[model samples]
Target chain A: MADLLRLDRDPAAALRETAQRAAVRDWTCATLGLGESATVLVTELSCAEPGCPPREVVIAVFAPHAPRRQCRIHCALAELDESRVRAAWLAPTPCGGSHD
Target chain B: MTDTNDKVPVTVLTGFLGAGKTTLLNRILTENHGQRIAVIENEFGEIGVDQELVINAEEEIFEMNNGCICCTVRGDLIRILGSLMKRRDRFDRIVVETTGMANPGPVAQTFFVDDDMRERFALDGIVTLVDARHFGQQVDANEEAREQVAFADVIVLNKTDLVTATELEAVERRVRAMNALARIVRSDPAARAAVPVDSVLGIGGFDLSRALEYKPTFLEPEYPFEWAGRFDLAAGRHELVLGEGPDPDMGLALFPAPPVEAEDPARVAAERAFKWFAEDVEANAPGTLLRPAESLAILDLQGTGSKRFPVQVDAPGRYWLVTQHLPEEFALALHDPQGRPVRPGLERAFAAGHTHDDEVGSISLETEEPLDPRRFSDWLSRELQAQGASIYRMKGFLNFKGVDQRVVIQGVHMLTDNTTLGPWGEKPRRTQLVFIGRNLDTQALIDGFDACLAD
Candidate 1:
């Protein structure tokens, strides 16, 4: 019963990654009130810093009439939740303003 | 006597890496073409190595710093080309070999936009060499590859031997899809001596007559800025106080009018003083009351609660401010700090429903009615001086009242080249223009051009 399903070779990981990205995109669009024309890119980025963790989910938003906005969640794509995304999206910019 | 001071034609060579550009260039150099060619070699590497690859011939070779010729190295090309022009023994023709991943748009635009570049050098054509083996992958992966083909007058389909007949046909189809007008020259990779030197060089692909008809793709860019406003006011000191935007660092470029020169000596003296203020503002120098050129005095607003700054206007004219966000987001106010409102709460200069692409966008206007030459010139001069930095490239064929020939106006930033193309020749007398830039107002530009039409 232990090795019956072979979870290690699960192809659903790729499918889950895609679905998670779509969910993240949908959530971002809904939260930001972005139009269909707006472009959203979600990726896993690695940072080599003392305080910064190795792997993180990075969300990039490009909407017309506004500057490009990028936010980083300190988690993997599969581990991303709506509350976590909301927190990251609402995080203050480097200049002390809300993320555009 | 031959005019030795005549403008030398510049042919820009562009393509992806390992695309037989060096082969084509070497062929041109070694060939007894009787033309003294000055080659400007631009490579994208830490150390410039492509210059060493060039075959030693009786030609002038200038190596540009390692960077994309389109962006960082563009200024280098202009400066080097300018220096080359000042020489006593000038080359008959100039050739610029841009890095593989280079957009030829800015390079081709240098000739059209720079005053000295236009007077001293003319853009002959952009000849792109396509590596037939990797054409599909390169075109798919690289925007530069696609642009090189799109902007080319000549496309050398090099390394034909590496690909099969079917593959070659597919590559040709893809190349044609990108640019139907470019003359595609097929060259074998094995045959180095058989390079199409004759077909590539001296081809006037950058014909201004045909360039006026804007390419649709050239206009497609998502502009960072969206809305813009143009304000006309009497000569006085004014203040533009910014409110807020989605981004804390909201940027707005204000273009104040250049001082108008009047015949009166008093007016001339006043104009000089006003111009000094404009210069100081543009330079971000402290103590200048008005700074039209700066972004509403962002540098001055450091650690300040209020975002208001004073600007001096010497002459009565129009001052335009193009903002990165919508007018509401950044309620940038233009008013006299001391005097009353000119329009009485009409602080919003001209709130346009301006929607452009996310990057670089374009706006074009075509009118059948002939425009008054003086009015058109004045409008263009003011427009360029104000918003030239954001406006990347502008070219148009103008139909004027008295002029027998059609006037072709080409500009890059503030630099413009206006030349008369001989006669309408039974064709439609139309004024057509295309402006490619970041956050341009299409309706505003169209309205401005329409105003130039004679009553």
Candidate 2:
């Protein structure tokens, strides 16, 4: 996802060890609303950089409220993305869509 | 202007996001019978799918600079269109696609104001599209929706296939309230082009014909207004109205009327008193209350014809808000340096204690248990007379103590008449009056509501 942001200079990078099936479950359980006790699987991850095992993992994000509920997280994220884009494209308008 | 042979009429295609504006534009571009068109897209905010849309000539996108279009439209629109006209052969008719939230004034003005530009580009009329699913939500609460309709030469109620007959009628009812002129067409873009380019080319002024005329009467004196198209108001409760109608005086009169500068102690003091207004509304309602769009129009006491002053309405849970002025009176006030309530009359009206030694506009607020419609209207009439406010329009739903049903009262000062909504039921939750006047106490009217409630 950071690749999508395409920010400057430092260029985001990260690392997390345990690179195994068990490690993947723990990380995802915490992230995917599975709670610490739930068993995990090799659902998602990658090792694009090579040499290093695929440390990055994937888990379902839950709603801030109604915890553990699979609320439309897409709405929240979509909202931010929607507004961010509208704001970025704005310049001088010939005026708003209003009239006398 | 250039002869019809060389210079083509520039049409502005505008409306809310997902209102099929681009879809319609794409239709015109890809399926046109025979006409070269160049398209320009100006988004309200940053993100834009202009690249995704099509046209014959190369496209250009202008981001609203840091300032507002009202303040900077002159410079920005000119640069884009001025350049477009330079590559005359590349395109024939120029179509402008505005961001769903962007106003269409500056865009329209590009033709009206500049001589050289005017000579080359003709004002082909404003074509605003409405989403059938969310037209009601957009028009009832969204200032942009009303603006778009008010100034439209042609309106495309796109997505007619998605809405119900009853809901579509409601959209037309509301649209009639805001605008008396406009040509409306129910369109399924994929099936039929909303309006053939020939019918649209060189069209000017509002076209008063469509899905609106046959519907029931309105709450205003205009009776059967020029209803053009029908749409779905409840289609998408989640969607908000995007584009406003076209503004002629460059955007001086849209809602959130242009800001009144602090030129002297008087204006400065007045502005200071109202400063808390923007922040307070935003704080109180959170997402439902504050609107950055209205921020520009509200701050002024003297009105600019550019924008509508911001007004708030509590409908169900969502605020059915607008800045179109209702009737009222006015009295000038002496203010304090801090812009607090210093004048006794100003203090009493707002019921606000703080005073400033500055000039503030004042109006009388009189409420009685019986709530005489005639008498109350008289007080209101007197208020408008005293303040000398150009009351463009006024409407409200009042539930009186004795009345069994709710009362719908509306007036367009230009028409000099108002109609009372009958067959009222349920006492009004609260008696509210909104004055969308310039340099006047919009807050004062809201405050009067709390004090003037049924006793």
Off by over 4 Å in 2: A1-100, B1-6, B43-74, B189-195, B205-455
Best by lDDT: 1
lDDT of 1 by residue, B1-455 (tens): 01114668778888898887766777777778888777777753322232322212112221121122321124445445544654528467877778787766667655643232445566767888998999888877776776677667678888888887657765765675445345677886578425656677766555555432323232222333444444676666877665544345544556653456335432222222222222223333223465565333332333434466577777666655555455555455667647554332112222122342233444657788988776777777667656655565566777877767876765555555555667899988988777766566667778788899976
| lDDT for each candidate structure | 0.59, 0.40
Chain A TM-score of model 1 comes to: 0.77
Weakest ten-residue segment in model 1 chain B by summed lDDT: B57-66
lDDT of 2 by residue, B227-345 (tens): 11111112112312112222111111112212343334222222333433333221121123223233322223333322222223222121111221210111111122233322221
